[model samples]
Target: MNDYTGFPAAARHLAAMIRCPSVTPDTAGTLDYLEKVLAPLGFNCQRVTFSEAGTADVDNLYARLGSGSPHLMFAGHTDVVPAGEEAAWALPPFGAEVKDGVMYGRGAVDMKGGIACFIAAVEAYLEKHGKPDGSVSFLITGDEEGPSVNGTDKLLQWAAGKGERWDASIVGEPSNPEAIGDMIKNGRRGSLSGRITVHGVQGHSAYPHLADNPVRGLMDLLDALLATPFDEETDHFQPTNMEVTTVDVGNPAVNVIPADATAGFNIRFNDTWDGDSLKAEILSRLEKGAKASRIRHGKDAPVNYSVDWVGRVSPVFLTRETELVGKLSAAIADVTGRTPELSTGGGTSDARFIKDYCPVVEFGLIGQTMHQVDERIALSDLDTLTAVYLRFLEGWFSGH
Candidate 1:
């Protein structure tokens, strides 16, 4: 058992984990390193590899301690996005360099740091209290930064098949934008993506009735979707907004009308809507616009089109019923002297999947630099987060 009191050791462990370069499908021994640290704490660890027919395989880990109900799971991802322009970093992105009072690395703030602190806190708690009265488990995946095809979603199913159940979960994503104690994510907005393709007859641009312009139809359909706001501010969420991310005609000659036009979009919506209802609404708007435009364009204009929903439909969720959120919030206030605002305003995370199984919330270090050029987290924040986790464990299991 290494010294849990030494925060330096925990930071060093995090640095070493970052150096593994475990980017998505290529774990590169990251899980092996984690097992080395966790096995000593009496965790029954297993590495589960999952694969979809057309997609690459992904490696994930499920480690549990204790064997009873009220199981608390800590979830996170060890994989990080590719470090672009590594030379621009003051320290190597994978160097895990600690300079001054902060640690610099690719996964420092996005994650990995949170995992390190939680492991250390749990180790300290076990050293003091022996085995916990309730179970503690870690649900870590390597595909979160990638396609998310074979990650927590599958691992949760695997654990459940083995008769594993969770009372609550905490995703160790960096939730606080300013400081560790400033925010706690009690919910997340749902996400939906879509693409629209408009088909038209190709012809010379100068010809009056020779061709139909698909780009015009696409522009009108896009206008219809964006013209009307999806919803005003809801109680637990912000107003839903959609953006056109890409528009492609693929025509090289300026004088020729493209045969087809394509546009891609995404929506971040609140709990006021679900995937089905939202999809219907979008389709209705597009259909209304397409029909009207086609009628107006008549036989000479090109207006044939199709719309497809792309990617997963992220469902909105809130964790108000769970004691984990309250306990962790109180613990944050106790340790940092700041009351965290329970919020759900952020991009989607793996919490979207975990929410279906157990009440889940997200809290970790400040996230100002996550996925940015030079990611870093202050050493003081690590200590504060560890203390918060320790207090939360005591308060939660003690039934406080």
Candidate 2:
């Protein structure tokens, strides 16, 4: 293997990337910077811009170095969440400042650092092995931190139309909560968000027979939804949970009952359930509770109610194949001298979209500071992650 003496160059490149205030749909010049770095590496880079009926146009990039089967893909996002309260930060959110051996920036751990390390590692590998044995590509999008309407989902379809296929894919999301090698995300719990708006007749608190109280109906529905445990423990996942995030009536007057009551909730389910089944289960529980609950002013009249669901459905998925998960885990141990946990915890990521195309997994720097104030990552950890990616590449291509 060719030795990479360009660790400083890689660090500088990452700093440049961090300097771009590419937050969500408005990726100032992040993609341009990426193209500049990849072009010299012999990657055929192309920008795919997409626009929806009402949303702003989004730009995504698909860069590939080689062609053929057994293709490997490294996917990530360049956009980051907004940096709140700049004055509260030790360094500017986009400064990419390195102090006392740690790089501080908005996207440092959440991901821009991973992209830099991988690109550098790939450059070093090509210096030694020439072109890779098969193929290697990058699928980067700017919409990961936004609505995600015109990002990886559309980019994947465009790539497939151009006859692109992958054997395995790795998303460089920071999956480790503690150290570089402490975790590897083999799967993620499916996320489903719903809003239960209970509609009822409005009434005065004193006039028992004049109005209806929607809050009581909403409470009953919430109780029914949470009454039965989704599951104690599935084979590969924890019990599914539903948390009531918000309940709003907007009733300022104490005596007036609100016409409508809304309760929003989200469920992180495991492999045992899918979108359709979970929806049915939720509706069933709500129906049963709504029938049993009697919202009465005195001892006579009860209120009638209805419920509605909101937002997109996310499916739960798990990848246990030995090739993708096993190989990456072994690589982590080899490089970091720690047995990484194969976890299914955490919220959804771009891996959710990639899983449909190929067996996908995630491993990168520790995410303890991701999306937090003064986000940062250690310089030594960057070197360790580069070595880990290099080791995985060598081992995976060697069929070991």
Name the candidate that leads on lDDT: 1
Model 2 pairs whose backbones collide: 203-211
lDDT of 2 by residue, 140-210 (tens): 99988887788988999999999999999999999888888898888888888888877767888888466
Task: Give candidate 1 misplaced runs (Cα > 4 Å).
Answer: 1-7, 294-302
Candidate 1 per-residue lDDT over residues 1-400, each given as its tens digit: 1222545555767877888887776888888998998999999999999999877899999999999877999999999988889989988888887777788889898799889889878987898888888899999999999888899899999999999999999888999988879999999989999999999888888883777788888988998899999999888899998989999999889999888999999999987799999999998898888876752255644357898899899898888885687789889989999999989898989998998898999998888988888898888888888888888988888892
RMSD of 1: 2.6
Each candidate: how many clashes? 0, 1
TM-score of each model, in listed order: 0.95, 0.94
Assess each prediction's global lDDT (C-alpha) against the native.
0.87, 0.84
Q: How close to the true structure is residue 166 of candidate 1, measured as C-alpha lDDT?
A: 91
